[model samples]
Target: MNISNYIDYALLKPSATEHEIIELCHNAKENNFYSVCVNSSYVAVTKQLLVETDVKVCSVIGFPFGAMATKAKVYEAKLALENGADEIDMVINIGFLKSRNYVSVLRDISDVKSAIGDTPLKVTLEISELNKNEIIRACEICLDANANFIKTSTGFSKGGATLTAVKIIKKTIKNNAKIKASGGIRDYETAIKYIDAGADRIGTSSLIKSSTHAHQIRNTKIYRKYIETIQKTTDSAKPNNTIKEKEV
Candidate 1:
């Protein structure tokens, strides 16, 4: 599979400058990445840069941490959509989840999803902080709340996506939801492995690299491997021809 198909090609750095955001959006447009994920502060700039292109602008709400007040998260979502963001990646409240406050968790996600209307909502589960049971419950909660995707981590967590976590998430969600594996996916191989484990999208900071010859290469061999693995894992996970084939 082509590597680009599996990548979201992220640029969510807090210190990104206006020039960098502009260049990044242009690269995404030219390269056809699935989307360019940025902080909410850059949403307007990113939207402006991606004006007429098919490349989508994604902004994070409640961002690296999911401890913001419910109203804050809702307002953030509304503002992002108003600014032309095509998708919003919001972090789940791990604190509430661990406390068994399922109601709050569900309501938080639901409120934001509702606020966005038709825009896609990806809820970051931060899988590293939770156990298998918690991960399953989180996926279920996201599904119940009508979240569009169950993202693995915030990249600011203690650890990022794991093969085991991705597998469990896919099995628990059972294709009812898409999976996004973020953080620690630095090379082409790791990216492919996550996809193989059932990640529909990959979030990483590395996209372009200058090779020894000084030519820029959009290296995503790692991501390609992850996709191949995802194909295999997904095939085995499904019982029959009942499973829908994912687009490459």
Candidate 2:
């Protein structure tokens, strides 16, 4: 199959430089990837780099962690759109979901979706941090929030997407929302498995090293970050039940 069409070529590392982002856009263009996913700061540059191509620019909101305030996420998502992001991938408020504060979790996602208008919003569940029931609950919540896609992970977590998790998400969301299987997907074989399981998009940077375009970025050694050094503190915070209006 045409794996590139399903790929969201990503580079969300906080340390990613402009040069790296430029290379990412070019690589994506060369491979004709569905989109180039980057941090909000790089959306403008990525948009510019891929302006002459059909590749879309995707920006991450609240990034690898979903602990930010709803207003802040809204602002970031808007700015990313202004800067030319075609889609938004937002991390869900894991703490709120874990604390069983479903209201806050629902509001957090819906608020962002509301702000983005028609832009496709992908809600990241960070499945590795959740149980099967939590995964189902998160997918249901995302559907309630009008999320366009239910993303599996942030890749900075302890683990990435698993086929089991994808199947669960597929079963949970059904035809309501699409699925994006991200994290830990390192090769064509692994990526295809997620697609077969029901993922409409594959968010990964690993293919950069294994694809035919490897020669394009081999010397820069830029693919190292794609493997992702799991963030130890990503899920360490205790579930806080307080639903403050301000940034958490």
**Residues 222-242, model 2: lDDT tens digits:** 555543433334445557677
Error of 1 at 56 (Å): 0.3
User: Where does candidate 1 stray beyond 4 Å?
Assistant: 208-248
TM-score of 2: 0.84
Residue 107 error for model 2, in Å? 0.3
In terms of lDDT, model 2 sits at 0.90
Q: Record all residue pairs in model 2 with backbone atoms less than 3 Å apart, i.e. clashing.
A: none
Q: Encode model 1's per-residue lDDT on 1-248: one tens digit a residue.
A: 45565567677777888888878887787767778999888888888888887788888999888999989999988898888889999999999999999999999999999998888899999988999999999999999999989999999879988999999999999879999998898876677788788999888777732132122233366667789999999989987756788899
What is the alpha-carbon lDDT for the whole of candidate 1?
0.86
* Residue 192 Cα positional deviation in candidate 2, in Å, after optimal superposition: 0.8
Task: Indicate the residue-level lDDT of 90 in model 1.
Answer: 96
Q: In order, what lDDT does every prediction score?
A: 0.86, 0.90
